[model samples]
Target chain A: MTGPRYTPLVAALPATVPFIGPETQERARGRPFAARLGANENVFGPSPRAIEAMAQAAREVWMYGDPENHDLRHALAAHHGVGADNVVVGEGIDGLLGYLVRMLIAPGDAVATSEGAYPTFNFHVAGFGGVLHKVPYKGDHEDPDALITRAAETGAKLIYLANPDNPMGSWHDAATIARMIKAVPEGALLVLDEAYVDLAPAGTAPAITPEDPRVIRMRTFSKGYGMAGARVGYAIGSAPLIEGFNKIRNHFGMSRIAQAGALAALADQAWLAEVQTRVAEARDRIAAIVRANGLAPLPSATNFVTIDCGGDGAFARRVLAELIARDIFVRMPFVAPHDRCIRVSAGRAEDLAAFEAALPAALDAARRSAG
Target chain B: MTGPRYTPLVAALPATVPFIGPETQERARGRPFAARLGANENVFGPSPRAIEAMAQAAREVWMYGDPENHDLRHALAAHHGVGADNVVVGEGIDGLLGYLVRMLIAPGDAVATSEGAYPTFNFHVAGFGGVLHKVPYKGDHEDPDALITRAAETGAKLIYLANPDNPMGSWHDAATIARMIKAVPEGALLVLDEAYVDLAPAGTAPAITPEDPRVIRMRTFSKGYGMAGARVGYAIGSAPLIEGFNKIRNHFGMSRIAQAGALAALADQAWLAEVQTRVAEARDRIAAIVRANGLAPLPSATNFVTIDCGGDGAFARRVLAELIARDIFVRMPFVAPHDRCIRVSAGRAEDLAAFEAALPAALDAARRSAG
Candidate 1:
């Protein structure tokens, strides 16, 4: 309390974490969860090649990573069918989003996001002192039209939207999203986050022209590639937008081992395809578990399924708590309406088995606790 | 640019890199540098045990690092003889400095530093729109008294100092620094960057308690520990100061492999001592090389030698270019006085041998070119 004072923005901010890690929850509960099916992490793990690359590159961690991120960017460009100038690799999509907000938003500037879209994004905007204007989700999905309208109304300089969204597991098809991008008001940049695009059906992602400067697309090795811990993410846009990152990014931020692992992850299309299939199967299994528990599961294009608890947010919160108490790690949305649903990530068969066995007793316990 | 327009701050920033890496320079030159002495990277590499631990942990890259950084922080606290609450691990000293600047500096807020202090610190201050007030170095060393006076005069929120300083490689003893700390004006936070402290002699570092609230001490594995690519650094201060970072930090930004690597790096004190000895030897060798070429080498407590070219900044610039032409990578200070000398890092025997062979030739070339 006697420390030299913080700047006004930092002093005014509450010491809040964007998400409670499952580890913290487990420690508080005095035991590890039987089913680690929260946080949307890929329980299936990374590709064998990626793991081997990381292991091999680990020996060379003594040498600082290439500050330029030259090799990874080149490899990513070839894999994605774009020029190297179109890509900028970073710690993760979360880290990249932080930098983007820092670059584009100043104090009191308006930024637009969907309500309950991604708390992490909102956290970044708040961190940079931007005024966040959230558009409510329309029918359990990110409403691009609403976001565009809000951006226009607020004169927002930045807008964030995640296709194949989290929590609600909703998406907009390519043409619909493309139209939305075209409709973005002047001076507004659309941050189209496609973190879950690999798990989505064909045409779920817009055909973004890398030459187009109006929108930047973000992707990661965290989801379908199953290397979340590797912390490799990239943003793709026009040369100018990509170049701007050089002005302020941690020059040597990328880890050599991570760059190597992500390069292998990008090169292995077969592994990604297999991961997508496994993710789809796990999603269906989770849906089946929800049905067995007499709850409805939303159709999902991502690695997680959102189950309606058949009541308000309070009931969903109780269910989440009961699941945690029963050694099942899961989460619920934060906003009302969406908060009525509990989210479960795809995990291994054993983890799913644990979830399936725990659901009934957990639900009953939640009901008793609520009463 | 037809792209989404950037905010005025971002648009005003030139797309610039702080330094062109040796690799990039080599590529442009169409040949590798015979002596890799620039950028201050440890050519001696990291502890073999640390490398082994990193490689071992690479298999577990599927799991995100402990966001609490519990194990690493506790280990660092024990190593530094402080409580865990006093330490906060981050990407690097560079990264932590960015957060510190963001926390204490607002647009148009004044900050003070030595005229030729670490450019990265100045970069961070400028990035946040802080007005930089520099105190010139007295006798090629950072003048703490002058810096304190400048801070008081300008009502600066933050002041930066690098002990066992960079560029000119000068240092102040611990007692002098403690005295300077006591003299610091009220409301100004002194940032002591001790990145090179491990390579310096005993008693060269101030003995301020880690719980001291007025000063934030930064340390890194990027220097003597030889894990620059790992991107691991930490700051020691009061609990409140440490907690302030939780307000806006990238919660999941750290790499699993990096944490494991840095943890191992910190645990190996024997390896650190050995590296310290080796760095000292290399510094002596570099000084010998400079002496052989008839240039004066400044006494340094850091891991590099600053060799006076015995002329003006223009002459030193010519010498640097001549060395670059001769495929020896080295750098010079960006500001006057200090810029009159060229900095060369301590490296392996082979790297020093390369420097030995090229120096005479480079000097001759520089003289001819100047004429």
Candidate 2:
């Protein structure tokens, strides 16, 4: 028998995994990595209170989670000093991105983002048959002016900008971001993704007003709160815009454990401060390790540090392979210039210790392989 | 300035909630539900092993869930005697329905289901601009023949049928389902939603093969497995069709705790059997309670029973209202003919006792209001 009739758009799309997960690599290697510093997971883990909350929630999973996400919304609103109407929650940033793309981008609609930004965002755009107009990173950071220019030129209805960007761990200052917000073309909605802002320095985030029509910002518990496995993310915007999510979102999609865990994590600011300190220390240690190997570590406001290998893209690829062979799990940027650097997450003491011991031999092997 | 520019279809679609959760109702009444039987949740709860697994997974929340869903897929495959490629896991049946509709039904494409079938399915159809053709239920059962006929007539690309159906608590046996599958119009795929099948009789489900290309059947942990808040649902279909989900789904949407819990729940068949026995006893009790109030109890293969109130839709609605006012959460169908009933789930002993105590007054109040 023939199969179901897939829509033309879906049929044309390839089954691509946006990110090759570390578990997949582990399976391929037939064993687990000694250093799990890839995927950018917080090695510090979630707050003890958050874990306790999730355990309590696990006992009550016989009932469905509130479809309205009411408790979490009110809690998040109170946390942000905005009305509950300004917030909407989803499975994670990935899930929210899909819903946002579906609501705003009809087939062939124009969307804009950096060429080497989050691949998950690009995956969503292509899934909805949206036309993507991308600007390359200026040096290692996302070029805000170029994105605004591309949006204006191509009439892109949605412009995606990740402050304290991923892959390169670079960010624009608050004033630069404010300028970018003003420069957004009239019809385009800027998606200010602040998934990492909780770990960034003060003033890294611009002040947001719920009624400000220019942008909808997203934040997640995945990076800073260290609950990536919990899969909680939320968007803040005008009431009407937030309410529009009701038209297309999967109601009752959130896991009850996730909601309870995120609420507890958000409440424990002291644990977050401890994580920030740990991440900073790890980042410093990572940079020193890179320097000892004669590689340059890029400036980072994010938890991960991107180290530039003293060679071309192929040399960086060899270095990455050598690292993987040495049981170190790390990733590099996908495109050129940026591809010359490999990214590493802030791991705990033993995990980082493994990385430090592996780097020298991995680098020497990469150099010999290139020669 | 205007907020984000929504696509014309989304702009036209009203912001609607398909189901009004009991939590929402409780908040409105500023109280808790004494007897919650509306949502058909498995009040008997999940396996103790599942709870322990979730608690353990909670401590590992620093890492993201395996995006590939490899371990869970293999487990489900082994349980079903199918290859891992035949199963695709999702947030829930609701989330899977959304993705299925997106993959198969392009804008303005035709789809078919019962007129009073699941509203969430209809919501997904409307969200994607699929034109839904509906046929009324025949003798309180979803008419599979009529659904197939309508699909053929309207060139519907997808036909939805829920065995052991919701609201009506009715089901078609295996042979009837097989005949319906053979009758599915060429180029149209049949959607067999067996969300409640685990609680049905021995011969209720048709035997399925991984190579079956004519239909995709969905199952969930929400009803019989007693883990509604886990948000785990899966579809068994041809490998190619199942793979198509990778194109649009939130790859990492499944929560880590949920994955671990569902895997544990699936392994403990004894727990599921115990829940089934408990549900059957509760259903019988519910039926007896309804008969005591002079209402007719419909025969059910599902986890809930629908009681005919011996009056019209409006009368049944009044009865439902009185029940809710008494802090007993019950629901009635929305459309006529079928709407003469109020549906209740098989709650535990205390919850059912609360239901038994509250019904007589609710019936009297409804009659008094009608008089």
Candidate 3:
């Protein structure tokens, strides 16, 4: 009873994850999923070179990773044509987002994001006691303009926009996003998440210089690079904004093997291009599967395809449950309207085939249950 | 441009490190260090089995780690003879410390720690806007009584005590630490950091129940397990206290390879025992080297020895500089009194041989420079 006491904010927060991981769900169900298309992880797997690098570095795990993340940052900077000072690497986009929110948000401060955007960002905003004003998605795509307008009205300090976005696989081209950044309003900073930029067509990411103080672009190794388990992500921005992460980040949080793996991943552009090709093929195949099921597939610039369930939220929920019951792991958005769609990630041919084979049965079961 | 704003406390804080990493210094020096004994990493390395497990898991890095860290927690709980609920695994002790501080310390709240102790803990407290109160070391050891008294005076919400402590490898027996834990002021929680305990002699850690609500004990594989680069650490406390971390922890931050590595490391008790034996031998060797050079080596229970240069902080610093100049990477405490001792970690036979050959020349060079 004599332990240190927690602050009111932390004490008030509940221990929760916005989404239950498939691993946890599998344990509960006593069976692993036949097809894991949820979480948007690259089931095509990382490049052989990245796997080799990680394996080689495994023996060197006794030495802490470079706190500066020097080599990886330099490689990333060179890849993006920026100075090393313009970058800071972290655990993942989720982890970087948490640090960004910590640096910029205080208790009861306002933050703006799409209502059905990445939930992890919202989790962090709430973790720091920030008051969030959520703008709903417009036409299945994140409405950057509405987000900026709300941020302006609320004097919000942070705005999140994921280009080639998640859950919906929608995108606004670079020029449009750059203009949105210009309209973010004074005192508010934009967090332009480009987690899926590698999967998007050229020009999807804005051409803003890394020195731009108005926005911090978040990129990750989890998707296109196929290293989600390595947990490497970085933020590119002005020197001050990037350096600001040092204020509260876990300085030695990164795994040495992960840094090596990510460095290898960044160096292997040919492999990245190949993965992009595979992801595109997978995206098309996913869309084909949705069409074969008589559902409308949204146009996707990212690695996933969002399929309209041709019904309401309830129907989508039933389809998702049926898919889970059929051992095909897939997910849907949390909010209304968007919840009418099921999101499936790009995966290996084998994994997608499992999904392809299981869908009709899952839909049939859902229909039977609905009846 | 404007964005969601930072809280006042976050805005007021400066980004800083308790210690500059050797890699950072290397970047400045434009070369890698010949010996990396500065960061208290176990150059002895992790178990072969651990290396193999990590390597095996490398290709599977495409999948996110189990967010619950269930398997690792279960293994840790079994290792400690406690229930699985009593343990929470994290990125490292550094990661757990940040979460604990965030949970307990808020703006203007008081927290106490030994002066010149682990600086990362202090960094986290400051990051959360907590007011810090320092208790000077007594006879180069963390004085638990003084810490308790300061906690009572400051009405501190948290107190940090590192046993088999860092910077200076001094420790109080379990009975003493248990007594101190009992005497902590009401509402002040004691954090018992036993990061070095596994390398210490028997009876170094307190005999506390895992379900004890008054204290939380943290351990790491970074030291004795020789996997610092793997970034795995755990905390043992009441279920409720352990659960509090989930409210804000990076759920998927752990590397899949790391989990496997740690699990393998934990299972290989014989490797740990062998390493402990080696560490003890190295400790004695370091002490003898110090004595041969006419310096004083403090008795140490941890993997490193702290040697007093028999002069002021400047003289000790000069010795450190000379060592680095000779390609021997060693470190020292950052504050007065404690800064009089240069700390050297246990290294391999060849590394120790290099340290042995460099010691006299470095000392002589340091003397010349001082003159």
Candidate 4:
């Protein structure tokens, strides 16, 4: 018997995952990584208060989480100096991006993003039948001017830009981003993904008003707040744009324990400051290790540092594979130029020590394999 | 400075929530629900082991949940005697339903469901610009025969049926359901929502192989598993249909803590048995309370009992409002005939006592308002 027919768009889409988890790799290898430095997850862990809140909330899982995400939205709005209507909390930045794409992108719609950028956003756009236009990074950073030019040329409905961006770990300051925001085409909305903004240097985030309908900024608890497993993230935008999410999002998707943990994490700013300090130290350690291994470390505003392997994309891939084979999890960019570098996340002292210990052997192995 | 234009379909859709949560009602009423017997939550709560597992997982929130949900899916597969390829886990039944509808229903695709059935399914169909053909319920129960006939007539892509159904707590035997499954029209997939099947009597669920492509069965942790707030659900179907979820679902949407909790809950079958016993006793208790109030109680195989209010829809609406005014949070059906009943969830002894104490006063108030 013939099964149900999938929509033409869905039928044509490939079944693919944007990123593979470390756990999946571990299961395949039949052993866990000695140092988990991939995926840019904060190794410093969440605030004690957030942990306690989640632990306590575990007993109260009999009731569904408040579908409105009332208290978290209010708290986030107050934190950002905007009205509650300006914020919409969701399953995470990944989940929120899916909703945003669904709300705006229909078949044949044009969207734009930087090449080698967050792949999940591109996945969503493609899933909804939107055509994606990619703009290459200038030097090591996302080129805002090129992205805006492409959007204008293509009449893209949405354009995505990640500040303190992934893979390359390079960032444009707030002043530069402010200029880019104004240059966004008249009808195109800029999706400003600031998932790593919390760990970025001061003045790195632009001073955009909440009522600017031209841009929606995304933030998450995964990196700076150290709660990736909680899957809590939010978007800040104009009321109309934010309210539009209510038309299509999964209203009861949030976990009650996560809501409580995120609320507690937002309250404990002191703990966040501690995490920032720890992350900065870890970045310094990673930089030193890369430098000691005779690699060039790029300037970073995020919790991860990208180290140039002094070779082409294939050489960098070999370096990453050697590191993974040596029981240290690391990743590299997918496109050219940036693919010459290996991305390493800031980890705890013990994890950094393991990475430091493994790097020389991994480098030697990569060199031998290349020869 | 105009915002991005929404697709014509999205622009035409109104923003509406399918279920107004009890928390929303409490906020509107400026107080908390004294007895939360409205949402069909299991007052007996989750297993202690599950709570402990979640509490432990709270400390490991620094890492994202496994994108593949490999461990949970394997456990679920083993429990159901199905291969891992035949099962797909998601955020919740509601979330999965949205994804399923998006996969099958393109703009103007036809779908069939009983009128006034699960509104969330309708909401998803409308959000995706699908045309919904609704058939009226036969008596208080969903008529699967009529639904299949309509599916054939309309060439509907999907048809929805909830066994041990919500709002009315009515169900059909497995033998009858097997007949209905055979009659499902060609090219149409039947969505068999078994949300409350865990609380139904033995042999209530139909014996269908996981390889059956004509029907997809949905099960959840929200009812008899007593973990509503965890937001975990799974669907069983043929391997192709199960794998198609990867094309559109949020890969990392499941909370890490919730996954651990659900895994532990599944392992503890004794806890589920105990919950089933408690739920049955509570149902009997609720039926007794309704009889004592001079109302007719429908025979219930689910956690909640639907009581005939011995009046018309308007009179039942008054009773529901009066119950809410008296701080007894309960709900009723939305359509005619069924609207003559007020649905009450089985609760703990104290919560049931509160409901019992408030019923007399609520009835008196409703009668006075009618007069």
* TM-score between model 3 and native: 0.98
Q: Is candidate 2 or candidate 3 better by lDDT?
A: 2
Residue B200 of model 2: what lDDT? Answer: 97
In the range A281-307, model 3's lDDT, one tens digit per residue, is 998999899899999999999888999
Give the CAPRI class of candidate 1. Answer: medium
* lDDT (10s digit) by residue, model 2, range A1-371: 66688999999999988999899999999999999998989979999999999999999999999999999999999999999999999999999999999989988999999988999999999999999998999999999999999998998999999999999999889999999998888878999999989889999999888878789999999999999999999999889889999998999899989999999999999999999999999999999999988999998989899999978899999999999999999999999889999999999989999999999999999988877
Interface RMS deviation of candidate 4: 0.7
Residues B102-190 of candidate 2 have per-residue lDDT tens digits of 99998899999998999999999999999999999999999999999999899999999999898899999999999998888888888
List, residue by residue over A315-365, the lDDT tens digit for candidate 4.
999999999998999888999978999999999999999999989998898
TM-score per model (chain B): 0.98, 0.99, 0.98, 0.99
Q: How accurate is candidate 4 locally (lDDT)?
A: 0.93
Cα RMSD for predicted model 3 = 1.3
Clashes of each: 2, 0, 21, 0
Pitting candidate 1 against candidate 3, the one with the higher lDDT is 3
- Candidate 3 or 4, higher DockQ? 4
What lDDT is reached at residue B297 by model 1?
Answer: 95
Query: How well is each residue in B1-371 modelled by candidate 1, as lDDT tens digits?
Result: 34565667667777776677777887788898888788888877788888888877777776777787778999999988888888988888988998889899887899999888898888888787789999999989999999999998998889899998998888999998998888778888889999999899999998858776678899999888998888899999888889898997888888888888888888888999999999999999998889988999999898899999988889899999988888889999988988889999999999899888888988898888888
Instruction: State what share of the real interface contacts each candidate retains.
Output: 0.66, 0.83, 0.87, 0.87
Error of 2 at B228 (Å): 0.2
